[model samples]
Target: MNYEFTTVGALIGLAVAIILIIKKLQPAYSLILGALIGGIIGSGSLVTTVNTMVSGGEGMISSVLRIMTSGILAGTLIKTGAAEKIAEVIVEKLGEKRALAAISLATMIICAVGVFIDISVITVAPIALAIGKKSGYHKEALLLAMIGGGKAGNIISPNPNTIAVSEAFKVDLTSLMMKNFIPAICAVVVTILLSTMLSKKQGVQVTENDLEQKEDKNLPSFIQAVAGPVVVVILLALRPVASIVIDPLIALPVGGVVCALACGQIKNIREYAEFGLGKVVGVSVLLIGTGTIAGIIKASALQYDVVHILKMANMPAFLLAPIAGILMAGATASTTAGATIGAQTFAGTLIKSGVSALSAGAMVHAGATVIDSLPHGSFFHATGGAAGLEIKERMKLIPYEMCVGLTSTVVAVMTYVI
Candidate 1:
């Protein structure tokens, strides 16, 4: 493919995909369609485009499998009331005076342990709302606290975005996570500060109507509730901590099983697994679709153009990874897709430019946090719905979320690039 044609096609395809996403088309369909259009335009043949898409989607199989397996742990935590128990303990300890900080920290811990950010927000929303009612904090403030904390934890998490970047850079997942730890902490601090400030600004108060009545059930003991995540963390850490290698695919399901056993939910494992699988099916498809677009971009001249432009401007080579990450995530309104596509397209150039794989992966992973909560993405609506926020109220939280993400991105640059 000619450089000019490929570059033009790639740019046009990305624009179309972003536009379609803004139009409320499903991201998976939009990305796939965009990939087909870009591939055909760039290669000038239908067969070539189809072949490239298949090849691209093939590259995401490992990531897809890891993400799918992660659902088991997520389902076990959410369905068995373990996640809520974890949140309740933290909030109780912190008390109502520290409600914002408590909710933020709880959500951060839950997400860092591997729950999806959206699910984390949903899981913690009720608690946050109840706290808001007692503390006289606005519902929007509580929601922002959870959203910000989730984003912070997400960067260092064993979640899909982290998995995608680690695989793309061929680095140990734990190493990538460790590299992101400081940045994640910085993000959390920012979340707490901003949320506290927002809490004091005076807004609509949480009322009884906003709260859901709880169903009585036998909740797990704290020890049992903590067991599952502890097992997964220990297993994952064993690679770096004890020189015992275990893939996440094995570790995640094992954690789920341990969690169920500890909680005495062994009889319902099949139901939990099914629920987990259902939650991840859409996400799995989204990753595959992102892979196709990434493949198209890789085969085009867009990357070279970006590098040449950066060089002409005398920017550091390491800047490309984060820049690509932020732009793609902003375009897609999804951190996982943005981080995956950015790493897939730029990891090679980043490595060749003298950046280490771990550094490159960390930079991109943090960058994806920026602008990932835009309204076009499901995170915006799902979380807003869970918090019962109006569209306008949700919109007000975007800048705070961006600030949290930017703080993490800056820390990543300092830790890795400087």
Candidate 2:
């Protein structure tokens, strides 16, 4: 293979993938097509391209399994009413005067405990809408608050993006998450401030018609609602705190079981597991597609080109991960895909350039959060619809979302580089 041709092929392939995603193609298909184009151009062999794609996807099985297993916990929290219970408690404690902050913090806590960001938004939407109507806050403000909090929590959460980056960089998941703690907190603070200001400025209250009421049922006690996430956190913490190693693959399902037991929904564990699996299937496929792209890039000279460019510009080495992350996530409009592709493609280069694996992984994870909520991605639509916002209102929230993401990225850079 000609090194220069491989580099150009890799770059073009990535560009083509981004274009496809922007054109409304599903991420999985876009990534796979791009990988094929790049591999064929780089190696000039059909068999080799297929082989590379398969090999790349095959390597992601562990990550895929971990993501799938995490569904168990997600399902338990969402289905058993624990997540709602948790949100309700937070809102009640804070009261209407602090509704924006309460909803933001509620979504953050829900997502930080391993719930998917989209699911977290959906789970908290009703509560946020209800609070908004009562507090005279704009619908846009409440939605933005949820998005900001979810993004903040997602950076340090045991979510798919974190899992993919950890595996890509060969870093301890818990350690990488710990490294993101300060940045996540900073993002939360930024979210609170921005949301509060937006609410005050707009004052276009959500109407009663916008509220979606859930069926009346007895919610699990606050203690029960908190128990599952607490158990998972303890298991994950044991690795760094006590020299015990429990993979997220094990800890997540165990936490789900604990959550179910505490919530008295253990009898319906199978149903919850199925529900969780359904939610994750799409993302699982997207990750495999991302892996194929990563493999093609890794096999090319693109990393060398990037390094040379950075050196010529005299930029700090730590900026590489974040730059890649922001670009990819902005292009794809999906944080996990962006973070995974960036980490897998550039982690080796970042490590070779004298950056530690944990730092590289943490930086990339934080960077992806910056633009993952762009309009092109499903998250933008899913979350907006969940919050009952129309296309125009949803569009208005982009800058604020970016601000929250930027806060996390800047904090990551300051913490890990200079």
- Name the candidate that leads on lDDT: 1
Cα-lDDT of candidate 2: 0.89
Candidate 1 per-residue lDDT over residues 222-280, each given as its tens digit: 88988999999999999999999999999998898898999999899889989988988
lDDT of all the models against the reference? 0.90, 0.89
Using all chains and alpha carbons, the TM-scores for the candidates as numbered come to 0.98, 0.97
Which lDDT tens digits does candidate 2 get at residues 229-323?
99989999999999999999999999999999999989999999999999899999999999888888877888788888888999877789899
| Weakest 10 consecutive residues of candidate 2 by summed lDDT | 1-10
